[model samples]
Target: MTSRASRSGRWMERLNGEIEWHPSQAVTTMTDQAHSVASKLEQLLKAVANNPSLERQLKMATTASAICEVASSAGIELRPADVVKHYANRLLSASDEVSVQNFDLCSWDAGELLWAMKQWT
Candidate 1:
Protein backbone atom coordinates (compact mmCIF):
# COMPACT_ATOMS: atom_id res chain seq x y z
CA MET A 1 0.00 0.00 0.00
CA THR A 2 2.84 2.40 0.81
CA SER A 3 4.56 1.86 -2.56
CA ARG A 4 1.32 2.36 -4.46
CA ALA A 5 0.70 5.67 -2.67
CA SER A 6 4.30 6.86 -3.37
CA ARG A 7 3.98 5.97 -7.05
CA SER A 8 0.72 7.87 -7.33
CA GLY A 9 2.29 10.90 -5.63
CA ARG A 10 5.21 10.84 -8.13
CA TRP A 11 2.82 10.62 -11.07
CA MET A 12 0.80 13.59 -9.77
CA GLU A 13 4.03 15.67 -9.30
CA ARG A 14 5.10 14.93 -12.87
CA LEU A 15 1.68 15.90 -14.21
CA ASN A 16 1.78 19.20 -12.25
CA GLY A 17 5.24 19.98 -13.60
CA GLU A 18 4.00 19.52 -17.19
CA ILE A 19 0.98 21.73 -16.52
CA GLU A 20 3.26 24.53 -15.21
CA TRP A 21 5.52 24.26 -18.26
CA HIS A 22 2.54 24.47 -20.66
CA PRO A 23 1.54 28.03 -19.58
CA SER A 24 5.14 29.23 -19.88
CA GLN A 25 5.33 27.78 -23.37
CA ALA A 26 2.14 29.58 -24.32
CA VAL A 27 3.49 32.84 -22.85
CA THR A 28 6.71 32.50 -24.83
CA THR A 29 4.80 31.84 -28.06
CA MET A 30 2.66 34.95 -27.51
CA THR A 31 5.76 37.04 -26.80
CA ASP A 32 7.35 35.90 -30.05
CA GLN A 33 4.22 36.78 -32.05
CA ALA A 34 4.09 40.25 -30.47
CA HIS A 35 7.73 40.88 -31.37
CA SER A 36 7.15 39.87 -35.00
CA VAL A 37 4.15 42.19 -35.31
CA ALA A 38 6.12 45.12 -33.80
CA SER A 39 9.04 44.57 -36.17
CA LYS A 40 6.75 44.57 -39.25
CA LEU A 41 5.06 47.76 -38.12
CA GLU A 42 8.43 49.50 -37.72
CA GLN A 43 9.54 48.41 -41.19
CA LEU A 44 6.30 49.69 -42.77
CA LEU A 45 6.69 53.09 -41.10
CA LYS A 46 10.30 53.40 -42.30
CA ALA A 47 9.34 52.54 -45.89
CA VAL A 48 6.60 55.17 -45.91
CA ALA A 49 9.01 57.78 -44.54
CA ASN A 50 11.69 57.03 -47.16
CA ASN A 51 9.33 57.02 -50.17
CA PRO A 52 7.63 60.13 -51.55
CA SER A 53 4.19 60.08 -53.21
CA LEU A 54 4.37 58.45 -56.65
CA GLU A 55 2.17 61.09 -58.27
CA ARG A 56 4.41 63.96 -57.14
CA GLN A 57 7.54 62.13 -58.22
CA LEU A 58 6.06 61.41 -61.64
CA LYS A 59 5.04 65.03 -62.14
CA MET A 60 8.52 66.30 -61.26
CA ALA A 61 10.20 63.81 -63.60
CA THR A 62 7.87 64.73 -66.44
CA THR A 63 8.52 68.45 -65.98
CA ALA A 64 12.29 67.96 -65.93
CA SER A 65 12.20 65.78 -69.09
CA ALA A 66 10.05 68.35 -70.90
CA ILE A 67 12.49 71.11 -69.98
CA CYS A 68 15.41 69.04 -71.32
CA GLU A 69 13.57 68.32 -74.55
CA VAL A 70 12.73 71.99 -75.07
CA ALA A 71 16.31 72.97 -74.38
CA SER A 72 17.57 70.39 -76.87
CA SER A 73 15.17 71.72 -79.54
CA ALA A 74 16.32 75.29 -78.94
CA GLY A 75 19.97 74.20 -79.50
CA ILE A 76 20.75 75.00 -75.88
CA GLU A 77 22.67 72.46 -73.85
CA LEU A 78 21.09 71.71 -70.48
CA ARG A 79 23.80 71.60 -67.83
CA PRO A 80 23.54 71.93 -64.06
CA ALA A 81 24.55 75.46 -63.13
CA ASP A 82 24.37 77.55 -59.98
CA VAL A 83 21.42 79.96 -60.39
CA VAL A 84 21.74 81.67 -56.98
CA LYS A 85 22.75 84.98 -58.61
CA HIS A 86 19.78 84.80 -60.97
CA TYR A 87 17.42 84.08 -58.08
CA ALA A 88 18.90 86.88 -55.96
CA ASN A 89 18.52 89.35 -58.82
CA ARG A 90 14.88 88.38 -59.32
CA LEU A 91 14.19 88.67 -55.60
CA LEU A 92 15.75 92.14 -55.50
CA SER A 93 13.59 93.24 -58.47
CA ALA A 94 10.46 91.89 -56.75
CA SER A 95 11.34 93.67 -53.51
CA ASP A 96 11.74 96.92 -55.45
CA GLU A 97 8.32 96.48 -57.04
CA VAL A 98 6.77 95.71 -53.66
CA SER A 99 8.43 98.78 -52.13
CA VAL A 100 7.17 101.02 -54.96
CA GLN A 101 3.61 99.88 -54.22
CA ASN A 102 2.88 101.71 -50.93
CA PHE A 103 0.69 98.93 -49.55
CA ASP A 104 0.49 97.94 -45.91
CA LEU A 105 3.32 95.37 -45.48
CA CYS A 106 1.54 93.87 -42.48
CA SER A 107 -1.38 92.74 -44.69
CA TRP A 108 0.90 90.62 -46.94
CA ASP A 109 0.40 87.21 -45.35
CA ALA A 110 2.63 84.20 -46.13
CA GLY A 111 -0.07 82.35 -48.07
CA GLU A 112 -0.63 85.37 -50.34
CA LEU A 113 3.11 85.71 -50.87
CA LEU A 114 3.49 82.03 -51.72
CA TRP A 115 0.58 82.13 -54.18
CA ALA A 116 2.13 85.15 -55.90
CA MET A 117 5.52 83.39 -56.04
CA LYS A 118 4.02 80.28 -57.67
CA GLN A 119 3.30 82.28 -60.88
CA TRP A 120 7.08 82.68 -61.50
CA THR A 121 7.69 78.98 -61.10
Candidate 2:
Protein backbone atom coordinates (compact mmCIF):
# COMPACT_ATOMS: atom_id res chain seq x y z
CA MET A 1 0.00 0.00 0.00
CA THR A 2 1.17 3.49 -0.78
CA SER A 3 2.04 5.62 2.20
CA ARG A 4 -0.01 8.73 2.81
CA ALA A 5 2.90 10.94 1.81
CA SER A 6 3.40 8.98 -1.39
CA ARG A 7 -0.27 9.24 -2.27
CA SER A 8 -0.28 12.96 -1.56
CA GLY A 9 2.79 13.48 -3.70
CA ARG A 10 1.20 11.57 -6.55
CA TRP A 11 -2.01 13.55 -6.22
CA MET A 12 -0.13 16.82 -6.33
CA GLU A 13 1.84 15.73 -9.36
CA ARG A 14 -1.31 14.74 -11.19
CA LEU A 15 -3.07 17.95 -10.22
CA ASN A 16 -0.18 20.10 -11.35
CA GLY A 17 0.08 18.22 -14.63
CA GLU A 18 -3.64 18.62 -15.22
CA ILE A 19 -3.31 22.35 -14.57
CA GLU A 20 -0.91 22.48 -17.49
CA TRP A 21 -2.70 20.25 -20.01
CA HIS A 22 -6.41 20.57 -19.32
CA PRO A 23 -7.93 22.70 -22.08
CA SER A 24 -10.97 24.12 -20.38
CA GLN A 25 -11.37 27.88 -19.93
CA ALA A 26 -11.78 27.38 -16.19
CA VAL A 27 -8.52 25.48 -16.08
CA THR A 28 -6.86 28.29 -17.99
CA THR A 29 -8.13 30.77 -15.45
CA MET A 30 -6.85 28.66 -12.58
CA THR A 31 -3.46 28.36 -14.24
CA ASP A 32 -3.26 32.12 -14.68
CA GLN A 33 -4.16 32.63 -11.04
CA ALA A 34 -1.52 30.15 -9.94
CA HIS A 35 1.07 32.01 -11.99
CA SER A 36 0.03 35.31 -10.52
CA VAL A 37 0.27 33.91 -7.01
CA ALA A 38 3.68 32.49 -7.85
CA SER A 39 4.85 35.86 -9.06
CA LYS A 40 3.78 37.45 -5.82
CA LEU A 41 5.49 34.69 -3.87
CA GLU A 42 8.66 35.24 -5.87
CA GLN A 43 8.55 38.90 -5.01
CA LEU A 44 8.09 38.04 -1.36
CA LEU A 45 11.04 35.67 -1.43
CA LYS A 46 13.20 38.27 -3.09
CA ALA A 47 12.22 40.78 -0.50
CA VAL A 48 13.19 38.33 2.19
CA ALA A 49 16.51 37.67 0.51
CA ASN A 50 17.34 41.37 0.56
CA ASN A 51 16.43 41.82 4.21
CA PRO A 52 18.78 40.21 6.69
CA SER A 53 16.29 40.26 9.55
CA LEU A 54 13.53 38.73 7.48
CA GLU A 55 15.87 36.10 6.08
CA ARG A 56 17.00 35.23 9.57
CA GLN A 57 13.46 35.00 10.78
CA LEU A 58 12.46 32.69 7.97
CA LYS A 59 15.51 30.50 8.39
CA MET A 60 15.04 30.15 12.10
CA ALA A 61 11.29 29.54 12.02
CA THR A 62 10.66 25.91 12.98
CA THR A 63 6.89 25.94 12.90
CA ALA A 64 4.29 27.09 10.40
CA SER A 65 2.89 29.60 12.85
CA ALA A 66 6.32 31.13 13.37
CA ILE A 67 6.85 31.33 9.63
CA CYS A 68 3.49 32.97 9.14
CA GLU A 69 4.25 35.46 11.89
CA VAL A 70 7.54 36.35 10.29
CA ALA A 71 5.92 36.66 6.87
CA SER A 72 3.17 38.86 8.22
CA SER A 73 5.71 41.07 9.92
CA ALA A 74 7.53 41.35 6.61
CA GLY A 75 4.33 42.50 4.90
CA ILE A 76 3.73 39.34 2.91
CA GLU A 77 -0.01 38.94 2.63
CA LEU A 78 -0.26 35.32 1.53
CA ARG A 79 -0.15 32.34 3.86
CA PRO A 80 2.86 30.07 3.63
CA ALA A 81 0.84 27.18 2.14
CA ASP A 82 -0.42 29.38 -0.68
CA VAL A 83 3.09 30.29 -1.62
CA VAL A 84 4.13 26.66 -1.45
CA LYS A 85 1.30 25.53 -3.68
CA HIS A 86 2.02 28.23 -6.26
CA TYR A 87 5.72 27.35 -6.39
CA ALA A 88 5.30 23.60 -5.91
CA ASN A 89 6.78 22.67 -9.27
CA ARG A 90 9.93 24.72 -8.83
CA LEU A 91 10.44 23.46 -5.29
CA LEU A 92 9.86 19.82 -6.19
CA SER A 93 12.07 20.07 -9.24
CA ALA A 94 14.85 21.37 -7.04
CA SER A 95 14.83 18.29 -4.79
CA ASP A 96 12.91 15.06 -4.45
CA GLU A 97 12.87 15.39 -0.65
CA VAL A 98 11.41 18.88 -0.79
CA SER A 99 7.91 18.05 0.28
CA VAL A 100 5.72 20.44 2.19
CA GLN A 101 5.49 19.42 5.83
CA ASN A 102 2.08 19.64 7.43
CA PHE A 103 0.98 22.06 4.72
CA ASP A 104 3.78 24.40 5.79
CA LEU A 105 6.83 25.73 4.05
CA CYS A 106 9.77 23.38 4.10
CA SER A 107 13.34 24.52 4.63
CA TRP A 108 14.95 25.38 1.29
CA ASP A 109 18.59 25.70 0.40
CA ALA A 110 19.96 29.01 -0.78
CA GLY A 111 20.15 27.92 -4.42
CA GLU A 112 16.63 26.49 -4.50
CA LEU A 113 15.33 29.56 -2.72
CA LEU A 114 17.01 31.82 -5.26
CA TRP A 115 15.65 29.72 -8.10
CA ALA A 116 12.16 30.22 -6.77
CA MET A 117 12.69 33.99 -6.77
CA LYS A 118 13.92 34.10 -10.35
CA GLN A 119 11.27 35.79 -12.49
CA TRP A 120 9.77 33.97 -15.45
CA THR A 121 10.72 35.69 -18.67
Clashes in model 2: which pairs?
Answer: none
lDDT of model 1 at position 18 = 77
Weakest 10 consecutive residues, lDDT, candidate 1? 79-88
Each model's TM-score, in the order given? 0.32, 0.45
Model 2 agreement with the true structure over 1-121: per-residue lDDT tens digits? 9999999999999898878555587877877877776766577688888999988988887755676677687776667676556556566656455545522454457686678779552
Task: Give the clash total for candidate 2.
Answer: 0
User: Candidate 2 has what TM-score?
Assistant: 0.45
Q: RMSD in angstroms, all models?
A: 22.8, 15.8
Q: Give per-residue CA lDDT, model 1, range 1-121, as digits (tens).
A: 5798899999999899878466678878756755554454344344435556522343354333443333343343332221223223335557766744533443557787789899879
What's the residue-level lDDT of 41 in candidate 2? 59
Reference-based lDDT, each prediction: 0.49, 0.70
Model 2 lDDT at residue 100? 50
